[model samples]
Target: MKNSRGSLVRPHPLPESASRPVVTPLSPSVVYASDTPDALDAQYEGRVHGYTYSREGHPNADVVAARLDGMEGVAGGVVTGSGMAAVSAVLLGLLKAGDHVIGGNQLYGRSLRMMKEDLPRLDIATSLADPGDVKAVEAAIRPETKLILVEAVSNPTLRVADIDGLAKLAKDRGILLAVDNTFTTPRAFRPFEHGADIVIHSITKLLAGHSDVMLGWVAAKDPALAQRLRVFSVTAGLTASPFDCWLAERGMLTFDLRFERAQATAAALADHLATLPGVKRVIYPMRADHPDHTRAAALLQGQGCNMVSFELKGGREAANAFTRAAEGLSFAPTLGDVGTTLSHPASSSHRALTPEERAALGLSEGFFRVSVGLEEPKALLAIFAEAVAAAVPGA
Candidate 1:
């Protein structure tokens, strides 16, 4: 290695036979090589073609980023190590000390905690408002407010946000509206179409659709913001691993089919759960009883989310019993798996919140969220029915 410039100087060529196949699956590579000194210099100088380092950029990451951008119809995007990484990159890259951010009260618990606790530590103030109440959200916005953070569909409860309304609110105030569209994958609801300034996704969920990868992405309607995010991602060391990006890209091939099937199952299961005596309430975007039904219908593009939530009359005890009885389904803390899984919010996702805080968000001891999977609907229904009966024999 005897280069004054930053270009990688290989001692010798990679050992290989002269003959090689023309077609091959693209593999994850951390570093690219070139034989010519001038070409290598050009690459190091930012004039030539390939990735010089893994942290800055890679081919696998580029493919995933481009596909995500295409899905959302956004200008550009970047992949990150995790969903929180994506969220943090956008907030830290775009916002600074003294900036004001408006966040939704019904956001994912970790996101809420970050805005409420971490942002204040950095002198970036945040106001939590229910996006469902447009007037309340508008009231909370201040002159210094620069961003509105919300979820396309809230976690655990499946409360769909009025993205179009929030988009208008952000536009009128000249602020950025960032929606975490993890619940409704871009195929189900393109946030850009509804005028969202930024669209974020926890690709670990439905996009991956198999629970094998951990990755996230942020796409921006504004190219400048996307560029900033890319730089921030690299410097912050939050860029997704090349292998994860490659795996997620492969998952995207069947995402449309998986999401369609899963959501249909969710809708059917929601209706069935509503009929169960043990379930006090069922929440799904397609249900008429859901408060956000009309709004979700308008925004969901006729495909409901791959989640169904319900409240059991007997509280946490019954939830535990049901999970024990549900032999075929996984009792996992996470969601968006190909195999259906159940999670208890009171004990898992929203466990950090106080009882009052949980209650305010309509989360109680008996509340459970079911992530519908790509399985036979009848088989899933039978397993759930058996579990409910075992949990509440009389009811």
Candidate 2:
């Protein structure tokens, strides 16, 4: 096949200096430097040259980073050992002793923990906002705010953030907008196209598809930023294993297909659950009743995704019963897998939160999260109905 302009795709070549003299290969010269007895600079190549050590760079990591770059539609990208590693890389890269960050109130628990712990310790500060509230985000900004971060789709609640709006706000404020795109995946929401300076994903979740590996990555338009982050990833020394990278590469190919089926199932399942007798509320992007449904319609390319959250009228008693009755279902605390997985966010993912904090985020003991899977929609519905019915607390 050929392009309309009749040109063949070609690989970018290494600079001339890199192709000869096995240029400056790392050795005992210094643990972190070239190991060869010969003076390292004698065979120097361009700065983009290969590893002086695996901590600096690795061929497999490069392969994974390029694959992630293509998926994220960015000028450059990097893979880290986990999602937090990528987040920390961006924070460490942009934040200084006195800088501050503004972020959505619905943050991953670890992120909340990090801010409450690390930033204060470093003399850097942070501001929190409900990303759903434009006014809240706007007001939270301080003169020291250097970044505004939000998840494209929040965990547990599945609140689809006002991505374009937040990105624009960040741009207007000269703040970097780094979006955590894990929940929505590249298939559901492409944040970079909406003005995000950086898009990060927890490849361990939907990206790997099968839940066999743990990896995270960041994609960005600025090659300089990407290159800088690549250095940070290396110096931080948390690059994914070569085999894990290989698995992620393989898993990414089937991402679209898997999520398409799962999303349909999710919609069906959520719709039915919402109509059930004891169901108080169902939160998913496409549902018209969702608080952010309008923003979801504008920001999400499709009708939400494969995650759903619902509250039971009976609170913790009903939630616990529903979980206990999940015989055939996987009652796991994890999300995004082939098997239908359920999690009780108030206790599992957000257990670290103070009662007041959990209430502020609308995550309560009655809230149950469901990661819909590739199973037939009807079967999922039947299982859900049966579980809910059997566990009716008042019954």
Candidate 3:
């Protein structure tokens, strides 16, 4: 006979059934039980299929990774705690001291910071180049360069990279090209199909299609490279929680529908903003006036993403007033939500850069980014038009 406390702690296991649940069951256990020491050793040695620790690997993360792999059409992938974790896992996992990295100047600010600030601390060298300019990237590469990193579509600025050109250059130089496809997602672009060695994503964005989860993933065209990244992620303890993974997977079910709705709204908004009184410029990949319009058309197949950025003639004051007057919009620092939101790049995304650096990137005081959402186009257009009038008064 067992004591009450012992009996309570050791609950009876559920009976096995042939029928399976329609939805995948969420497994939140951090540690798993093994039949014996030999079985545990076999699992640890990779001779058997099982999870021992959540930090190394788990069922939820595996399922999500598999789905991402299918979407990217890659050999394999791994999920991490955050987008930055995926970035760090790739950079820190593959490169060692004395190696060099050539990265795009217009990447997400934190990624740029990691290259310029963090990599240097570890004795690794980094150089910045305009990813849209393939010749400039090639010029920046050195004999020791092991990696070339760029975003499929740059943050806030919306500079589209020449992925094919960059991939060819990297391959000829024996360097790996890592493309961050967070902004574009797989629906807009697939890096692997175009010769990229690695593809990264901030799954918190359009892939998840909601702002509920903070998760990211990295996929590799080569199985060996994917294994390397997975090992490094485990060692660094960058694995995502089961709950986050589950939430992200759920969000992915509606990704295509959500993305299509947001993209349509963004396109209409871009055209409307360009004709407004106080608007100075609109930056959208599909716009003919965009710097990378031709390349974006070819790569994205005329399907631009949901992100839209514009500059106001009144700069900071006008931006502040617009946010205050905008009826249905929220002033959020992050992006990819169901509700339309505005973000100030100068104060939010690109604040890490020095004033001079930010000016060079064309992120001025009036610059604002819009994450279009599932909203009625007419209502949003009216709201923005009224706010613009209120902000720049009589312009």
lDDT of each: 0.87, 0.79, 0.92
Ranking of all predicted structures according to TM-score, beginning with the best and ending with the worst: 3, 1, 2
lDDT of 1 by residue, 237-285 (tens): 9978888887888888888889888988998999999888888899998
lDDT per residue (tens digit) for residues 187-281 in model 2 = 87788898999888888887787767788898667788877787777777867776777677677778888889989899888899987887778
**Residues 79-159 of candidate 3: C-alpha lDDT, one tens digit per residue:** 999999999988999999999999999989899899989999999999999999999999998999999999999998999
As for candidate 3, its clashing pairs are: none
Best by TM-score: 3
| Least well predicted 10-residue stretch by lDDT in candidate 1 | 21-30
How far does residue 308 in candidate 3 sit from its true spot (Å)?
0.5
Would you list the clashing residue pairs of candidate 1? none
Candidate with the greatest lDDT versus the true structure? 3
Regions of candidate 2 where Cα sits further than 4 Å from its true position: 1-49, 393-395
Error of 2 at 148 (Å): 0.6
